[model samples]
Target: MNEFQRISPQQAQALRQQGAVIVDIRDPQSFAAGHIQGSRHLDNHSLHDFIRNADLDAPLIVSCYHGNSSQGAAAYLVGQGFSQVYSLDGGFELWRATYPDDTAQSPAE
Candidate 1:
C-alpha cells in the first residue's frame, strides 16, 4: 500500500507549523548549504540513528534536492512504521524559492 503523500512546499509549511518532523535526505553538503528551519540531515550515514531516536508516529516530511528522490525516502520511513509521511513535492529548491525566510544556513562546524 502507498504509505506516503506527496505535498507542495506550502502544504509542507502548514505541516511544519503543526509540529511535523522535517527530514532532508540531501547530502550533508547540500543540506549544510541551506535547508528548512529545524530540518534534520538524514542521509544514509545518519538514517539509522535518526530512526532509532525519532517518533515513528509523528508526521514526517521528507525532502531531497528536487522532489523525485523524496518519494522513496518517504516510503521507506513509512515502511519502518512511520504512520504519517509526506514527500515535499518540489523538494528543497522549491521550498527555498517559495519561502526564503523559512530557510536557515547551517553554521560551519
Candidate 2:
C-alpha cells in the first residue's frame, strides 16, 4: 500500500480521539509559531534521524504548510515499515480553517 492516504480535518479529529500522533514537519521555528494541538515537531529532511530517535509504534499524522511534504513523509514512513501513518489533507492551513481552538501558535517562532 504505497499509495498516499489523506485524512480530512474531520477524520483527523476522530483519529485524534483514539490517540493518533500528529507530526508537524515544519522546522522548529515554524513549528513553534503554530501547529495542530499536541503535534510533535519533526523536520522532513531529518525524517530517518528523528524517527530513529523517537518512538515508532505510534500512528503518525504527518503535516506541512499545504499538504505536500507531509504526504511525502507518510509515504516514506510507510515504506520504512510504519504500519499506521497518515497525512492531513490541505495541511495546517485547512486544519486551522476547520479548528481554531484546537490549534495554537507558538510565541517564539
List per-candidate RMSD values in Å: 1.2, 2.2
On residues 11-39, what C-alpha lDDT tens digit does candidate 1 reach at each position?
99999999999999998889999999999
Candidate 1 differs from the real structure by a C-alpha RMSD in angstroms, to one decimal, of 1.2
Cα distance off (Å), candidate 2, residue 46? 6.0
Provide the TM-score for each candidate, comma-separated.
0.95, 0.84
Which window of ten consecutive residues has the lowest lDDT sum in model 2? 50-59
Q: Encode model 2's per-residue lDDT on 1-109: one tens digit a residue.
A: 4445799889989888888888888778777878999887786476668678756666678889888888888898887877688899999999989898898777752
Candidate 2 Cα misplacement greater than 4 A, ranges: 1-4, 44-49, 53-57, 107-109
Model 2, global lDDT: 0.82
Alpha-carbon deviation at 2 in model 1, angstroms: 5.5
What TM-score does candidate 2 reach? Answer: 0.84
Model 1, C-alpha of 64: deviation from truth (Å): 0.6
Question: Which residue pairs in model 2 clash with each other?
Answer: 33-106
